[model samples]
Target: MTHTRRDVFLGLGAVGLLGACANGVGGRGGATIDARVDATLAQLYRDYPATRQLADKSAGLLVMPLVTEAGLGFGGGGGNGALRIGGATVDYYNMVKASGGLQIGVQQYSHVLFFMTDDALQTFRRSGGFAAGAGIAYATPQKGEALAAETTTSLAPVIAVIFGQSGLRVGATLEGVKYTRIIP
Candidate 1:
């Protein structure tokens, strides 16, 4: 058998798409997504008490309970989640990512975005797809310590907290995530 570079790329793309879909990107409607959101929030607040304040102050929240990513040279990932406004599920969203760089390995992680202003939440909801930007502040947790919302996070309209990572990936960063609203 002879496989060209294009053939390999096509095969990888198909496998990545299938892997994303199989992760239940929009599988069971809002129920499963909301459940995961609730559990994720509970765990987050319990583990990082400092984040509860951010949640309380934020106008909305987008919680992606689990996103699985894998790659040898190219990589992709997807996950289902819920957006909460006023602490209630207002919409469902799916996150997808793709990247090509010096990367390899598989990983799973949870991420939550706190929309600190109504304007920010509205902009995200109205967009066809929202991508995390430089303005977004990240509250990355460290070992044996609660992540505190920095002054920069308070100034930014959107704050992202990524935690509960389990994988063998060398470095993890949500640099190219594209989030879109989903019916499920």
Candidate 2:
């Protein structure tokens, strides 16, 4: 068999596309998403009781039940989630990220963003897309550790808690996650 550079590139592209599909990328509807959101929140409350305080203090929450990320020097991730206001799912959202760095492996995790202020939640919904920025506070769950949301931390406009991690990926960072409201 003979192959050219173009063929090699095309082959890589196909593999990447297949990998994304294998991650279960589409066809999630309202009922399915809401069920997952409910389960995810229950698990979070069970696993990290301290997070309950964070949730209680927030005006809204964006719950991403599963985010699957895979990388081989270049990386990408996609996940579907629900945005809740006043304890009801007001909208659906999809998160996607792309990055290039010295990274390899695959991981799956869940994350929730707490909008502490009505303004923050309003801004997020009004924007076409929202990106996690430096001003946001992060509370990564750890085994046998209590996520203490001090008064100052709770006062932050946006708070993020990442937990329920599985797979071989070394680390997960939210630097490039971009959230877009979706019909699902």
Candidate 3:
């Protein structure tokens, strides 16, 4: 009986170790990752240069941090993100399939969502529409790209995401991450 108990304990210990490294564990490591995210954001902005300005210009900035999920063959496109505006950081999650702009890789970085128009912001905030169609503009930096740029052609609102952005420059296919409005 003692031996069996010891084995069980050992198994649990292994699981605990695995959880620490894995995403969504929400334990000490998860908290650490969040802190790291903040620091990384600082670095990203510093390296990229235009990131902070874009965030500041947006009607609201939604930050999706360290989403560590496996995308088997389909949608792992969206995960939980935070919406920051008026000094409030609201928690949110994304549930989208890419149609136009994205990369096909395991992305584990935070996303900064930029809303370049008032209508998109208003719609996102008031009409409760976080889904694409009404208003919003976004762009994601590639996994290696240092900078992502957008030239807004539509006054109707746009959401262009610059995905797979690391400190490197690699272009990703256009696959939009779906973002649903999080009820505050």
Candidate 4:
């Protein structure tokens, strides 16, 4: 099989489409991922109710706008999420530089993570400034979102806001992707 640049993108596109088949939840195996998203969001609201107040705080920092990329390379699953710190929603494709292995297949998932504290929130404020060290639990889920619980590198004044992603599977380290705000 001669895989040229075109073939590479074609494979990526196919995987991406399969992942996009669902709205990030309630599709095929999406039930699990969606359920996780909902539980996490509810817990986030309870844990960091203040984030609602700080939603307008994030700015200048990396804005990772929600993006849907179709790829058939290694992993095939589309999930959308937004993380707001200092009034700016910092999430999207280019914002979070991803660098890790991948898994490809037809799947759908959704999730949102809030940095529940001031220091942790600030860490991400810098352009590509998430001091994620080795074994620094990158992605986790609630119920199935992430049993490890929220990892607060430091206790800074902050809150977490998660919504509509109750069931999803996030690799220990899914790289190069981020969550950007969506202004309606």
What TM-scores do the predictions have? Answer: 0.86, 0.84, 0.53, 0.39
Candidate 3: 10-residue stretch with minimal lDDT: 68-77
Q: Per-residue lDDT of 67-115 in model 2, one digit per residue for the tens?
A: 8777655567778889998899999998887654455577789999999
Q: In model 4, where is the ten-residue run with the lowest total lDDT? A: 58-67
lDDT of 2: 0.79
> In terms of TM-score, which candidate is stronger, 1 or 2?
1
True-structure RMSD, every candidate: 3.7, 4.7, 10.4, 9.2
lDDT of model 2, residue 55: 84
lDDT of 3 by residue, 56-76 (tens): 566665556544322212223
For model 2 the local lDDT of residue 81 reads 88
Where does model 2 exceed 4 Å of error? 1-28, 151-155, 171-175
Ranking by TM-score: 1, 2, 3, 4
lDDT of 4 by residue, 1-184 (tens): 2345764676566654545444332243333433433454455445545433333342222212122333333333334434434533333322222232333323223334434445555555544434233322233324333222223323223322223332333333344544332222
Better of 3 and 4 by TM-score: 3
Model 1 lDDT per residue over 43-80, tens place: 99988888888888889999999988776456677788
